[model samples]
Target chain A: MKSNNSFRYFLIFAGAGIYQWAFWHETPGLNISIFTAFIVPTLLFLYPESVKKVPFWLVLTGLLSASLAIVVHASLFATIMYVISIILFVGFAHWSQTKSPVFAIPSSIANLVLTPYTFFAFKNYVATNNKKSSVFLKWVKLFVLPVVILIVFFTIFYNASDKFAEYSDKVLFPIQDFIYNLFGNITFASIFFFVHGILLITWILIRNKNTNLSDAEKNQTVNITRNKVRRKRHFQFLGLKREYLSAFILLVLINLLVLAANIVDIVFIWFGFEFKEGMNLKQFVHEGTYLLILSILLSMGILLYIFRKNQNFYSKGKILKVLSFAWIFQNLILAISVGVRNYHYMEYYGLAYKRVGVCIFLILVFFGLITFFIKIMQKKSSYFLLKFNSWAMYLLLIISSLFSWDTIITKYNIKHCKELDYEFLVHMSTKALPFVDINKLSTDLSYKNPWIINSNYNYDYFYVFSMRNYYVKQVFNFLYDWETDKFLSWSYYDKLAYQNFMSNPELVKSYKIYKDYRIKKNQIENGNKNSVQNRTPALHSDESR
Target chain B: METKIQFKTELLHYILMNPVRSEQSGRVVFSEQFAIILKIITS
Candidate 1:
């Protein structure tokens, strides 16, 4: 309380408590935009020394990502971007102070999580500069663990036995009442938010005074050095000339192989192959997916090997360089080939998480090959390749989050898919529920007729029908859960979905019917299972019908 | 004719091969029954 920076510390702590009370008291919103607003300013204003040393573009990008959270519809993607932005900015900021680049992310993350501990355990002199604070720490050290254990035991007993809970309530009611009156109805969730806020600010302020990872990457240079050849005891096989020849030959071979594969894909898959309804599409594109992955990995390996040293400096290196560029170009086509393969697969089978993941992976490969091209032209070291590709990955990840993939998969599959995997569609998110509702499907004639959509999959018609009912039940349950979760654990898309469901009269009517159907269906089926005589008649009559 | 087949198949198969709900809902029932028993015992 009496340190030189005691008031500043108090202000930081009070800011956390007030922020928790204001925007966070319930489930804390997990709203990264709001969080970023608090964090960026607090760190800048209070601990300018730490955040300001980062380059202008880096800081601007961090701020832009933080601000994007406010502009974009809140999603898991925005949240991840916000977190990674913070981590990168802080990590780089901390790493910059150490004069390093490539390994900043890991070390800075370590700093972010462990800062409060580091601050309290070693740097407590900044906080507890008074004699009374030492006494307080001693008291806390002796009592906190036992008090925590007691509280845990009490909670377990209270939950396990109603008698014990009632007895404890009777004894503790007056004290609880007194505490409630004194604190104006405090909750564990609120306390957690308050503590989290303090920890976040602590991370912003006192993070990684000692940089570990940046030091490791401090001397990481971009240029690949050419060492003068010193003959090592007749090991002529280890010569750079031989290495260049071998890499050139390998590239020439792979280039021809990949070009041939790409030609087949372009001719058949891109322009010629047609999707039939009953094809085993699950196996058709399955092997193609792995081939694309292996090709991409192999291309990277080829580039890394050929460009490992001064092979690019040889007299006949022009042809090798041509071969390398040609190889990268062919690999880019191979990436496009997978994109087409995925499209064909989705055309028949349907768009789901797997197909979308392939699309994203293709984008990553495209960036990687492009970076490889750059690495060859610039003679950039392996670390530059790592660094540039990671940046590309960061951008791609943020962009990918902009769309609600679940709803897109659902709507897209329903609109265009030749065959529907009913089980998987049933298991999809509530965001796509209305799109698949049987009543809605009937009204919306643009889509194929209900049977036609889910038909070609090799399952019993009855099984698919029951699945439709189950899907309806799922939607109803989701809306019910949304109603209860109005303010608690708020998500933008979920809330928007709730509003849309409530406003649509047809959807509401359908929900009610589905709910009623599930109850009746359960009762009738249970009764049939219990009655042996009835079961015999029902089976016989079903056959007769 | 297709609609009739679908309806008949749905009616029969739904009863015969409904998903095993009891495997999941059995846990829910046990917890609910436990709560009731606990209430009675405590009272």
Candidate 2:
């Protein structure tokens, strides 16, 4: 028993040390930090005797996803991957410790949402443990009193003696400088990671220590309570015949509405029929996509309410099932229409982060509709449907995080779209630099508004354009700076792109020429104030100059 | 023993429902000081 406690303490200490070392340094990349995060918790909290038992594959996959995130330069993709990794890390830890049913979304959410309270609880528990923690508490108390006295005495003595203060300054200033150098570079982000990592690891280690019942036993107890409730409350609020009739009427009305919307979408959007007057693509897409998702959710709620346990035991339940299936099918069609509307919008205006999100959301809704169908067919509870949908969403998010959408969006716009929005591309993060076709950009300047490109351009736009150029130049300069260490930036993908840009002299020359033209044009325009009213062709000729 | 158990349960309920008063002024209560109250109660 003593040896077991000693091992647990050792694991906690080791985990905390590793967390500080991995995350406290400057340029701590996503991969090593995520990997250590998972491994440390598993080492500290998961043992055979522990109630929660985490499978090894979940941890491995989390580490792999983190590595994938590190390799990609796109901030969105890396952020998603990092988020997924953290979720899996905490989820698996909670699952292992509680011996709860697998893929318990609520447990994972509770672990993350209640982290502060969990840390507090663990701290309280540790403080109460006399055998392992009392000695440390005693030492801390002993050390604190003397340090307080020493600081008070040192302040009084330093104020009293000028000569003593001058001599002490020589020693104290260097020590202060050393301490400043050591701790000054510690950023808020690094401190957050350090504190959060320790709290999470400690919380996981001690969370399961008090649990006496396995999940199966807990479920049995809940079932018994539910049975008691079931006997006391008669769920037959309405007669079977009336319930069936109401559900039938509701499903019929909803299905008709869904069908009408789908037909309109099929004609106007899917078949490329001309839209009604004043109905632009933006208005059509934005207005319908989100409302359609809500309708589908409401449809799910209706089905759940109508087909609840006692209500489904009617002789005409088969008719309700059929009607509900038809309603789900109609909702699926509505979801597809939403997807088409999004696609139309993307085609008109180029791809963006939100459009990609809508597409993913549409896919999830499609799966949810299917899950609703299965729930009806299998006579499964709403809880089962919710759990299934949550897992599906989790898996989809993880899969989506592996791809760099910025590159995909850039390449698609360049290769497939008719009009390229250069301003938008320029404002994008450094991740899209590798995919930007400079040659294509030079030729595609025709689509830009003439007034915006002329000598009297808006100051705000000019400022943004110049800032974009400045950022590109800074990236180029950073690549060849040679004085700073290479590993300081933390992004391997950004370095690789900059290195590639530097290696190709022709591309480098093209970029420099383009940048110089824009700068010179701006300077020439700013030099001539009267040139603004004339809309001079001379400023346009500056492109050639 | 039963009376002691009931007293403890009632005390827990009272502590949970009522706010903690500061030492300097009993009239000044803090609703967010549950952790401190919990520490005191457990000790």
Candidate 3:
């Protein structure tokens, strides 16, 4: 608080607090406030010695001010283009900073804020710039990687296509679909990803802080007169503990689980497969439940063996005993909760090829094996090549046997149900679209329908009779007035009311001619002088026109 | 008077999305009534 830089720090913190407060109110404005957070804090945190940095704040203020001014502006796209200039100019300036890449923080900020705009910008940049266009070709291999994997998977599962159909047709498959819809949803994935990133960043920051603190201590020993705040700050930062180590290890496992999920997604694509509704959650729970149970049982056995070895009763200490039992208890609870949620009813259970779930399970197993390695290393106090070899052998045997049997079973099932069921395909298409309420559909349609024209040919009409509409209404009954507003459109009525007619050049020209004629006729009826002003119209409208 | 009228119009636009109990009544203003509270703070 006494330092000259302290005021700048206070201002940065205050501004950030205000930004977050303001950010909570505006749905999309959160991104802008977040951008400001990165910009202002990063400036003060990096360089506290500058007046020119004030102009950056001014630019940010102007952009927001202009946003308010242009809220009612007809052309939102043009307004967006103008806002892009503010973001880009500031971003470019930040990136040009030569020292520590504090500016990289704002780059991330820009990425989040202008994700939609910047994606198109990057695409355009590549399209227009000759030098950058070729850069895309270099990393095209990443996209090809999934294709190659899919090809390999298809080749391996060549005989199981029929089985896939049979498995999908089962009544219990919808339950599986529901599980997937609930648990393996993109929302959960996004939340998990965000949490994982934060944890990773926290770990890195902690490590850096430790290094800086140790360096500061070393410097203190070298310099004699720097008692600055000696005795008071001695215990402010504690050395790393076994607890933090465990947390870090848990973080790594979480990351591995996420990676496994992504790999499972790839396997699904490779097999030309989809998770059954309600089954994703079940599958997710099932995979995790089994691994955790196995890990707990295995850990319990190890703990019991340790207790026997140190049989002095006193050596079997309270803390160690509690930790071992707690770990087992936690794993058991995890298994039960997941199992109940996913596979509680025997009638609901069925066998299906969930390669994604399998893949994610494989990842967890991999982490367990790594944990095993760490344990052996800790106990032996040495690196053991034999331990690694034995572990690999065990994993290979388990994986190959499991996969081979599953494949065989799947093949047999598919072969029995060889003929393609048109009904099943129709059911799937219906499920994908869901039930559609005209009112809800129109609201969704509003953002996309720029013409602002709701006529006799309501957007709801298309959705009401549609298979898509039925599917939508079955799923989302949250919208009010979802049951009503059922209507249909004839082709001619649809063309005039909807924006479809405007899309065709010939129709547009014809409409213009008809509109002018109607206007003049109306004006003449009203005996208005403006009727003459409308007379420079087409003398003869062509058939196409 | 001029500044107040302009401010009132701007504020009206800002708060238009929010519904009030009545055009003329005692205002039991909720903290989250208008997004402008956040807008001004964030700015």
Candidate 4:
């Protein structure tokens, strides 16, 4: 008994010690001081089953002072460490079924201050905006993004950090990194997931495929689906037992939503944008996360409505049905709209022109659809369905592979490249043109007496031209039919500008006029804009290798 | 009969007290001191 007692203490102490040592090496200065002070006390306080006898509040105050010693410069790491400690405490609380842990209040307050700072850092640095006004305002979408990212990264640590560092360093640096990564790209993927879940619930309705039943039977089926009950014998969370089946279904829906949203974003980005706000299905789904949070309020509303209408069976039933159906219907509408838009994109891009293959695919699909409908109507399916499904999946995989191969081949060839006629590129980004000698641009050119000027050292030609000014502005406008008076980075295509002028000698007259104007003024105001207007041919090929 | 009850209690306590051995695979598999203590009392 004594040996076991000693062993348990030894493991915790040893593990905690190793974690602390690793942290000391990784963290510098004030972080080290505060961590060193807090580690021993945290272990001591947390170790006891009951600190009520030993003045827990006084001990917490001491812990708080020590934690506060952690410097702001080390805020990123310290904040993360604090968050991890909070999470650990949460786990402890869960296990013990008590929230009265050592330094609970002080630690909570410290985290409330520190966590927001980490979020703000990400916003100011990564998100790159000047929109912040108050401390609270700074902790908006931008703040949430980073904190979420941090949580994800911490949750999934590599073997090197989790296993090796756990014993050697008592600090939670890996956890901090995890949090930063989570907030980094939550909007695009996270929102999609939320919407995808709602859509999936609706999709289950669409995919039900039990069409042969009479209206009463259909209604019965719908009722069965709607009033689906799940029973659980033993499992519990938050002191409440859940229906295991319902929980599982909800989890599945959540996972599907995440996957679908991610896929939508990926697919939309892969194809060029022709949408308002350049938002894909992924972004739309992200907007749905804001909607899902409304579920709590909606649930409350549903409960109240049920209480109010408990006497009227029809009203109560209708209210419940509407509450359940609303999410599904909204999700279905979103999915259908996005799917149509995707088809429209396919048509516009001349991908639909290659419809011979698609026609054959449609014929095969027609047969499959007929068979599926017939089976559902007759309530009859073959035993060989599993085998058939496997074969069909394999065939689909092959077809998909072939399609990808064709697309890849087509992607590389200049024959399929979108034509950017010379006039458009010349009008967009002359700043990217190599007409200005790199040597002269990089250094100030003093041809006349003693006037000195700063040289143009914008080496980021690719971003300034193709990505920002050229493709984003002019091309997007032409594609989407959206009018924006302001020109953006995508408008420029220097290659097109050069091609337009090169076809005829008459184009040089505009260049000559610009040259004469420059000679007379000795400087051109908005030279970049003017140069784009009277664009020259690109020095190299337009198609990027 | 007394010995059997004590043995059963010790077994129950051991099962509850010990950290599941399967989880602590590669790293040093230190025997759980707490479980051993609980076991001793029941024994």
Give the number of the best model, judged by TM-score.
Answer: 1
lDDT of 1 by residue, A1-545 (tens): 22334444565686675556445423223344455566666556544455555352464465465446424344444555666766666665444453332465677678767867854553442334454445545776999999999999999999999999999999999998877654654568667867887777666555555546755675777777776776568544556677877877788888888888888989998899986768777776778789778878977886887777667567668788888899889888888888888887777677777778788888899889888888888788888888777767776776675676667777888888766655566555565555664432221113222432355422334343345444444556566455433253456666676787778775565454433434544444354332211121100000000
Every model's TM-score on chain B: 0.35, 0.36, 0.28, 0.32
Model 2 chain A lDDT-worst window of ten = A536-545
3 against 4, candidate with superior TM-score:
3
Per-residue lDDT tens digits for candidate 3, residues A1-545, read: 11232332234344444443333212222244344445544444433432255334433444544343233221222234334434433442333331111232245343444443432243332213344445545677668999999978865665578775565458557888887643443455455544443332222111111111222222322111212343466455432244334434553454455346435543543344444666665555556557655654565455434433122133224444444444443443443343333333211333233322443344454444444334332332111222243334333432332222222323333344344221222122111211211222221222221111233322322322322222222222111111111121011111222343245454344334333333433343334533322232111101110
Stretches of candidate 1 exceeding 4 Å from the true structure: A1-30, A46-78, A97-102, A112-116, A122-205, A228-237, A276-278, A438-473, A486-488, A504-545, B1-43
For candidate 4, write residues A248-361 as lDDT tens digits.
345356446645754674466435545565546444433443353344335324322322211223322433333333333333333333444435444333332123233333
Q: After superposition, how far is residue A315 of candidate 1 from its true place, in Å?
A: 3.8
Model 3's CAPRI class is: incorrect
- The interface root mean square deviation of candidate 1 comes to 11.9
For all candidates in order, the CA lDDT equals 0.60, 0.56, 0.34, 0.32
| Ordered list by lDDT, greatest first | 1, 2, 3, 4
Q: lDDT (0-100) at residue A517 of candidate 2?
A: 32
Model 2 agreement with the true structure over B1-43: per-residue lDDT tens digits: 0111122222233234333333344442444345434543463
Q: How many angstroms is residue A326 displaced in model 1 relative to the true structure, after the best TM-score fit?
A: 1.8
TM-score for predicted model 4 compared with the true structure? 0.19
- Residue A116, model 1: lDDT of 70
